[model samples]
Target: MSEPTNLPVDPEPIREILKNHQQQIRLGLRMCAHCGLCADSCFLYRANDRAPEYMPSYKFLNSIGVLFKKKGKVGKPAVEEMGALVFENCVLCTRCYCPFGIDIPALITLGRRACRSQGVFRAYDK
Candidate 1:
């Protein structure tokens, strides 16, 4: 197999989009309290022995939430971390539930899109 490489990213367009699309993103991001109730919704989290980073909230919070908070000025390391969430951690199956009504699946999906737009993706996501 080929080696995994960090995704090449350009933050300018991402920053502009985050600035323009602050409507629902802000509310959606803040809705979660990282309560961990959404853990069961993901097979990866369940099968992985409930690892903290595998939880849906972690993916949502770290990916889109971080981007929103930083106004998309995230460095390469942050983008790589988001890739972990989007690629290896989350498959965007869209089958998620949140007791706190946070809609975790949608948030993760948004994160996936943002990462995709910035060319931050693994060729074969686990």
Candidate 2:
């Protein structure tokens, strides 16, 4: 609903946020190998006829991982797009079974919480 915010030009705030949540963010990003196993585990993916966007790994990798790569220096529009994956789409089924035993739900929740901290809640989130 807003234009590009041009946020965190200095990188300090992004760096501080990275310091705060570095471990899980890094862990989640590293653990996922994009094998698409978690996609089969997600009910949304199943119900949606295996649509690519409903895949948990796809959502997190594209949204949260992208944010981590950008070091949290995202605009409002970016956060909203991330929210589509992190909040609107995920049901947090805790079924994103990583063969590596990574906690997909936790990582996605972390992203949602980070967005929440930024007052980026979508009206559709229950």
Candidate 3:
């Protein structure tokens, strides 16, 4: 079998998209409860036998919650870390909304938007 090819990941466009939708994203993040309902709804969680990190709320917590707890006073490194979790792991697929009846992908997208506004997303290679 051939080896799997790794595709290039460009964070710039994701950042730009997020930047354009920051307010909506911020509002969505503010409404989450980390209730784990979204986790139950995640395919990743099901496939992985319920790893907490795969849960949508946990992922959101890792991104938005960290920023909120720090009140955006975090350093660049921390921001970058959170951005990776938000942008890389999340597909903005809206799958996690089933359990909680909440729009989690929207929330995640909003968080990404915030990251984009701060120039925290990865730069695309020309």
Candidate 4:
């Protein structure tokens, strides 16, 4: 397996990329009701003993939510951290259900895109 490499952080392009998806991010962020109903549907959450961080809403809130809130001005380290949350933590399972009809997988995908712009992504062994 190759080691994960860090690319130099450039805030301008990251801002631009995120700007393009502003609408979806904003809608996803606003759609979550925070009722915690989706938690039980996640295998990771249940396998991990119901940790709050494993919950879909919690993951979205902490990663995508934080990225949008900061307006993509965060550094590489922050991006990497959020990458772990969205990329490593989530598999875009699409099994996570929101009674309010929120699209959790799409939002997580948005978070993945944000992380990719910063060169923070999952490293697979060849």
lDDT of 4 by residue, 1-126 (tens): 113556666777667766887887788788877899999988888988898878999888777788789877777777777788887778888899888887888778877877776677787864
- Sorted by TM-score (best first), the order is 4, 1, 2, 3
Show model 4 residue runs off by greater than 4 Å: 1-8
lDDT minimum window of 10 residues, candidate 3: 1-10
**Candidate 1's residue-wise lDDT over 1-126, tens digit each?**
113446556777777667766776787776777677888988999989989898988988888888989878877667777877877887778777887677777777677777777766667534
Each model's lDDT comes to: 0.76, 0.73, 0.61, 0.79
lDDT of 2 by residue, 1-126 (tens): 223344533445445656787887798888788788777888888998898988888777766677789877767666767777787788787877888777888778766765665556566433
Who wins the TM-score comparison?
4
lDDT of candidate 4 at residue 5, scale 0 to 100:
57
lDDT of 1: 0.76
On lDDT, the candidate that comes out on top is 4
Clashing pairs in 1: none
The residue pairs found clashing in candidate 4 are: none
lDDT of 3 at 27: 58
Go through the candidates in order and give the clash count of each. Answer: 0, 0, 2, 0
- The lowest-lDDT stretch of 10 consecutive residues in candidate 1 is 1-10
* Order of candidate numbers by lDDT, starting with the best: 4, 1, 2, 3
Between prediction 1 and prediction 3, which has the larger lDDT?
Answer: 1
TM-score for candidate 4, please give it.
0.87
